[model samples]
Target: MKTKVLGLCAASLLICAAPVATFAQPVAPTPPPHVRESIYVPVRDGTKLAVNIYRPAENGRAATGKRPVIFVFTPYRARYRETDGKVVEAALNDQLALASLIRAGYVVAVADIRGKGASFGHRRGFQDRTEARDGYDLVEWLARRPFSDGKVGMIGCSYLGGTTFHTASTAPPSLKAVFIGASDLDKYDFVRAGGITAQFNTRPDEPPSVDLASLPVDGDEEGTQLRAAVAEHAANTPMAPLWYGMPNRDSVSPLTGNAFWQEAGVYAYMDAIKRAGIATYFWGNLKDEPTGQTLFGATNLGSKFLAGPGSHCVPPQGFDFTGEVVRYFDHYLKGVDNGIDREPRATYWLEGSNGYVRSDQLPGVESRPLPWFLTGGKAGRQLGAAPGVAGTAAFTVDYKLPPAEYFGFWPQPMDKHGLSFTSRPVTAPMTLVGFPVAHLTVTSTSPDADLFVYLDQIDAKGKAEVISFGRLKLSHRKLAEAPYKNFGLPWHSGLTKDLLPLAPGEKAAVSMTLTPVSRIVPAGARLRFTIAGADPRQRNLKDIQITPPPRIGVLHGGRDPSRIELPLAR
Candidate 1:
């Protein structure tokens, strides 16, 4: 009673200090310094989901009683294997909410999603929605347990945040709120953009420090054991060619028939969620999000974060959901009063020319267009297609090769063979909010072909920051096979289709989705789109048949018209 009263008084004090409700204004941006860790929490399923408990460890003493729980589900290793899950030898480092909530008298849990870390299960991304079920089960178990106050909230990055979407739609009774950063629900922008796969690109190598799920158990013959496992899984499944659940490499990819694709698509669940009246604040990386983020249009360049100089997007500060998460649970569970109702209700971060910008609606606001044309080549500043007529550029590289180094699922850099055409400084700053569509009428001598388009920001000092990029196979353009079947509506998934290949000098309207960005290319800086066969973040194989563009291209057709869309500040 006393804590609730004190919290209410504090909120009242804050309200009195402000002249009026500033819904458009940003949230309080600072946090106090106090954090602690708990070593364990076994879910109802007997799965000992490793949890790093965080709270005030001031003077090595913890508050005597149960605190509200903020649980984060991540695929990353929760703790080292040898610890019996009792000691958190280390914490999941990227998320900031974990640290901040502990200071606010809440118990923060970093739960390793099932199938990853020490948690036992065959690991694959969103596999059969097992993690989502784990989340619901954990909530009910925690609410009834003594260590918890029977209230739960969630937070995390990429896959961690992605899990929140699946679980959120289910509305676990114990789950009252969540802060999802860099995640998406649906195949909105995963693969088959414009109805084709632009793969065979190299993925960026994983940083040595970032944890990978398939680490081998210590043994005299580690390499052989690991290789055998990889081989077994690889052979058990040949899902990739079909883009379904394959083994090893693609168990987590969308192609996996696992629960991820089995469950109703994210789009299938939105109307249900709105009907349920659940309020969740969804967000995504301003930069790179491999799987779900862009699929639902949650984070695009314009309304999301745009690339910029000196902005090292390390340890994304975006997942830093603080005191607000606590208030959400309090309002729903303890009946404490917090101003969540009066705020924007939902928020997303935008890298405006001036720091971070906040908004109530993301897609509707930033999805508008800012069309620019590609002009000039190998020479001065030229971007997009020429005003009325379309334009083209051509470069050739080996098709049998991989673009860059590969690790886990992400590919390293094979960017050298890519071609870049840049625009001189914009008189002011420019922000791209949606996918920039490239209508390249192409041709190649090869019977089949592949292409990739990269949109980047060239800074004042000649450094390049990638905004958004996409890839596709020329054959899957119409999304068919020997046995043709037209799936549901094409535009709903929001994938830019890849079709119309090159045959010697033959041309076709080849579309590309410049991964959405919203960074301000500073004055005197440039915007460049590079066309190549691969990128560093995805696995790539050289599949290009070089015959170059016809020197001019134009807006072929589509609801978005043939052009790049920019999310400008209102």
Candidate 2:
């Protein structure tokens, strides 16, 4: 009887295992999305702009449906050739973001601006007027395509983002919305911030390489068309002479006889963009180069913004904004009833705080002016609430001082290249969340000088992290009434007519507004403000080599009380 019972138990176990094995069979994986490459869309000038269309896939083929289009216009190549010879889309490295929108049944299109990639024509200048007209034509052309539903939205970061603004300013009937990231609204402010030309901005465009050549469009299998297009780029205007030669906002370029800054900037086309009524969403990083433009777009263009603490065109780690992009497009393009429209206009990541903050407008709360006077004493240079005894601090400009890594998330030691003023340890946590203005009373031995101011937060362990910085050329120190709302910050017109060179040994009051920032300083942390004459990062082409490095003196206390005013959260 025991043997019979054991045999029955074994039979029951086998019966149960049969169903489990059947259920564990391998499942098929989802197919990759589909893309139609090398299509040329003609603009008004009969120039064919090369574009790659990505469509939602069904059973490994493009789905049959009329879908709203997400367009990207970029000077950067629309497609790139990898080392392995595989062709891929290069919409400002926003493939993941585009992939999400494509999966949600939207057709995505990326086009090379007039002269770049496989497109036919020559680039006149950076974001020239012709490019803006081309964008208008492309939007209308895309709307008429068989796969499109007569509605379109623009999206990109950096140069690509700038194109979106330019295109939207044309007010294409089909263009419904735009999502911009890390793009400059003011051209002069970016290329020549504070009247000092940014060296990196004047560098020549990257020459094509074997491992990184532009990918040929679909029918150009022999790459004949691509080569001809590249040859046309030989006539492209060199950036160095175009940017460095200007020196001022109203300066005309001898090459084109055009006021490049006045025509190229989105700020110049603000009225047109406002008339277009294109829904705008600007993604900005506090640590990026265009922080000021980000704030300007938010406050002036009726744009919703998401400002993070990442560098350049990057978003904060582990923070995916793909959903937010889709949600925004969904509401405007598809007329979805998602609550994104009802959400706050601004969302920002406040560093050293509880993480992200949401509010109807940027900053979320009122800010009070908190002034810190520069003082020098036995304890070294200090930043105090009250003015110290009258005195002047002198330092010779170090032209040969090696350029430090200008911007990053890491901490760097404060070098002796500049004068540093440190504040006492904070007794209570303080949140600084706006632009900072540095009012400096200075005298220079030379006729003119450059001033660079840096603000850093030093922790208990003595690690100093730069928070915000600004620079100005002394000759461009004349102030002017801002054409638009300037958030109450001082505005330097940076025009040739506004030049004010300093006389030797004559004191001049200079006030410069640093880039916007949002950081929380905990108790025991100290703040440091450094003033220097030269930053190799922003070298002017004409002034690269000065005959003699000038000595600069900062007159503090007494009548000329040099101070830095910060916007502290109330």
Best by TM-score: 2
Question: How much RMSD separates candidate 1 from the native structure?
Answer: 9.9
- Cα RMSDs, all models: 9.9, 11.9
Error of 1 at 190 (Å): 2.4
lDDT tens string, model 1, 90-169?
A: 23232344545565566766666654553444434432355667777766666665667777777665556666666666
lDDT of 2 by residue, 11-114 (tens): 21111111111122112223237656568777888887888888887887789989999998877777877778665565323332676787778888889888
Note the clash tally of each candidate: 74, 1
Clashing pairs in 2: 38-218
Query: Which is the leading candidate under lDDT?
Result: 2
lDDT of 2: 0.77
TM-score of each: 0.66, 0.91
Report how far residue 283 has shifted in candidate 1, in Å. 2.7
Model 2 Cα RMSD, 1 decimal? 11.9
Residue-level error in angstroms, candidate 1, position 492? 8.2
| TM-score between model 2 and native | 0.91
The lDDT values for all models are 0.46, 0.77
